[model samples]
Target chain A: MSGKGGVGKSTVTACLADGLTRLGVSTGVLDADLNGPCMARMMGVKDHKPSSQNGAMIAARNAYGVPVMSMDMFLPEDETPLVWEAPSQQGAYTWRSMVEMSALRELLSDTDWGDLDVLLIDLPPGAERFQNLADLLPDLTGAVVVSTASQTAMTVVSRSISMALNIAEVEVVGLVENMSTMVCPECGYKDRVFIGVETVEELARRHGVPYLGAIPFNVGLADFLETGRSYIEMHAEHPAAHAILEVAQRVHFWLKNQSK
Target chain B: MALKSTHGPFDGSMSIVYECPTCSMQTAMLTNRAETQMVRSLGVKIGGRTAPEEPMETLRSNLASGQEVSPERPAPSTGGKCPFTGMVNDAIGAAESEPEKPVWTEGALARIEAIPGYIQPMVKRNVENFALEHGCFEIDEDVMDAVRGRLGI
Candidate 1:
């Protein structure tokens, strides 16, 4: 999934993996966001360490037995920050990008994923990394873009979609609107969180991609984040979980049609 | 070719004349030590040695007489060992000495073929690696099932 930062790309990735697994599809996730990797924690494999076998790193499994590989697994502690060793910090910018690319390459190639039907790579924000990933995985199936209802996120996410369709020349599976609306937990009332210039459905129509679905901003999801719980698993009947599962179903049908 | 003035000599700059081994096309450029080191670091070999330093009068006279004068410092010997070449040789040697990839039985190949083309490569590679790790020289349906069992899928 590719999108602007804070648009819930990681959250959507976790939910999709969970939903896909529940649908009986073998799915895995590669947390490509090196700087801000939260998949390990979100997938409830934060404390698991990846073991090496025959020069390939074994992926960590979540509670559902879904393999996950992320830079967060290599971190020593939650508070420990990721830092690259360099000769000097004066001009680290020039080489830091290359180092990050190399790290991503190693993660993709040197990990023993053990055969997965779907490997959802959770890309960090920005269109550049999408281009890098496209270059790395030539046969990339497609990209799923996530965006919030805010105009700022829409503006940035539109550019990302353009980069995927125009520059990367890959198919955009669909667009999923995250936090499209907020539901009042007290009274069960729905309201728009951001009064934007355009709705996500209009943006998807403009780009000519499928509008997967919209996930409501649920307080339960936020609490699950703090508790390291799978919201989709626990609250499968909730509107937010139902929307995400529908998106996953659409993606599965799309993949089935694509394979044919 | 004409000698182009690039950077100053104080920064370890020197005039280099490169003669192509194939076409004998001579090219001249003024480059500094920093640039040479940078190029060498990228695994490119720079030809020609630097000429010894001479008096300004002698240099001027040599230029006037159309006599080629070398730069102040000699370029390192092209015969010297290149770290890049050594690295490439080591990689090639490692590959040559490595064990052969395990063979996939017809049944196993058919099972892999049943997978989608996009993910077939990954699935095949993972299964083969798994087979190798388990000391299996031939991958069949049993090996495939074992991989699934190991992954608990």
Candidate 2:
């Protein structure tokens, strides 16, 4: 999954893994958001530590049995801060970037994802890091681009989609418009709260990528995340979750088509 | 001569395991980029994940059946240098699998470890070569004496 930061990519990813596994697909979720990783905690595997073989880490499986791997799992403690400030010495940043990218590649290629039907990668935001991941995995089936329905988010989202389509040479599986509306918990009324004037469907049309669907801005999403429960698991009837399941089905279909 | 292929403790890092052929000494290399890249690109599997086998899988299996698995044969020389090991000219570059580690007596490996890494491989190679020439795999104190006598040292 690729998107701007805070655009609900992690939630979308978690729901997809849950839905896919429920649908009988052996699924794995790779948290590639090194700078801001949240998938482990969001998947309720925050305390799950990986087992080691060779030098590579085996991802810890959550209660849902979805194998989850994140760079943060290797960190000493949950509260330990990650500060990657550029050094003052010449070529230090270049060296650091190379090492960082190498680490990223190792995470992707080294993980023993055995017989996974689908591996949903929760990528860090921006085209550069996405491009780095693209370079690392040549066999990626495609990407799911998440965007909030705002002109500002669309501009960055479109650029990233183009990078994936044109430069990365990976398919843009579809576009998911997250936080498209706010659902009133008491009355069940849907309000188009934060999508600005335009919708992601229009953006997807312009980009020529398939428009998967839209997710409602549910306040309970935050609460569910805080309590380490996936929205799909606890609130399957929630509109946002329903939309995410629809997106997952589309992805499954797309993957099937690619196989054929 | 049971062969042992054990990796550096599992840490999600690319592990380099040195499989000892005769005495069965297992040394892990923490795998350099070339080693890791080779395995991943070839899709070389890990524990309990090996199936729908690929070319490298066969290579590894055949490699286990007394065939040499030279993960070092095609090592990409980084601009006439090795950036992974951070070494420069005349240094014996770190190798993933070198098959021919001339047997060292109890204190010999420790002594070789004391040598600077930049020159240790060269020293090891030279000593191994000396042993091979004399058909002596075990380089104990007596073999060292023979080598010293031969080198006029």
Candidate 3:
């Protein structure tokens, strides 16, 4: 899953992994968002280190038994937001991007992911940065682009979809319109809280991509999500959880079709 | 939904999020750093880097309303000026200073020229960048192949 920053890409990723795991599907969550790898904290494995065996790295399994790997796992306590300066010979080409790309490549290839039904890679949001991983994983089933139900988010997400389809040359499976509405659990009042030029369905239709439903605002989600607990497990009966599960099902069906 | 982001991703006015690590700066599309704290207070981690402290009210007002932050610094320039078009260019790549230009063999120059005119400058710059990166003075078929692979052209 990938999209512009602050698009709930990580939350969606964690939920997918959690949902997929519950369905008896072997899953792996790859935290490809090198700069700000929220997966570690979100997966409730912030300090979980990937064990080095022989010369290869082994991904750490989270509480849900979902094997997870992130750039954060490789860093020491003090070093966060890995700052690596590219040499002068390399056109100020953010050496950190290249380094993180290499690290991601190594993580994807070298890590003993072991046979899994799917490996959900949570990617950083950007055209060029996301494109860096394009050559590494050419056989991607498709990308699930995430965005909030807002014009600014959609604009950046539009670029993400274009890059995935054109530059990265990856199939865009669908778009997730997050924060579609905030429902008052007490009064059952619905409010379209975020500012969006058009509905997410309209945005998807305009882009010629599949419109995977939207995730509503859960009043408890703010504090609940910070707990690092899987959303599906925490709020199995919540409307938000239902939406995520449905999205996961669509992704599964899409993957199955791609395999066929 | 719960994990607050400094200034929601969409403000109907912003499109590009700037992530500058060195200066510990980050701007999301229309969101500026002045509101970084308010965004953080909203429980949204703005960037991996900590934002330098500023007035809370300004940040609060900006985050609350998605208004443009005051006294905002202008964005960084592209710096990549085109040699042929003279417009800001990324295709042309780093301009070659006299001391830095690698010596291209006659065969390599011929090979480079043989490429279509429209793409020659880009290919030449890419090849030069590749050569400079690898510290290769000579452009053999192997070097040419490496450059092609590196540039994916």
The Cα local distance difference test for each model comes to: 0.70, 0.63, 0.62
Error of 2 at A60 (Å): 0.9
Error of 3 at A14 (Å): 0.8
For residues A1-260, write the lDDT of model 3, one tens digit per residue.
Answer: 55577778887787777777766689998888766777777777777755556445677777667788876765444233343311122332323334445556666766777789999899887767667667777777778888887778887788878888888888888988777889887898888868656877887888898988788876666455545567887788888889888888887778789889
Residue A140 accuracy (lDDT) in model 2: 78
Docking class of 3: incorrect
What are the chain B TM-scores of all models? 0.37, 0.32, 0.35
Q: Which candidate leads the pack in DockQ?
A: 2
Contacts from the true interface found in each model, as a fraction, amount to: 0.00, 0.00, 0.00
Report the TM-score of candidate 2, chain B only: 0.32
Candidate 3 chain A, run of 10 with poorest lDDT = A85-94
User: Candidate 2 on A1-260: residue-level lDDT in tens?
Assistant: 55577788888888778777767779998888765778888777777655546544567777767788876665445644333211112233334455456446566666666778888888887788777787788887888899888778888898999898988888899998888888677897878856456678988998899998887787667556545455676787777778877887888888889999
TM-score of 3: 0.59
Cα lDDT tens digits, model 2, B1-153, are: 222333322111334345568766776555443333333333323222312322222222212111122321232334333332322111122332333566788766776676545344435655666776577888876776666554433
Better of 1 and 2 by TM-score: 1
Q: State every prediction's TM-score relative to the real structure.
A: 0.65, 0.61, 0.59
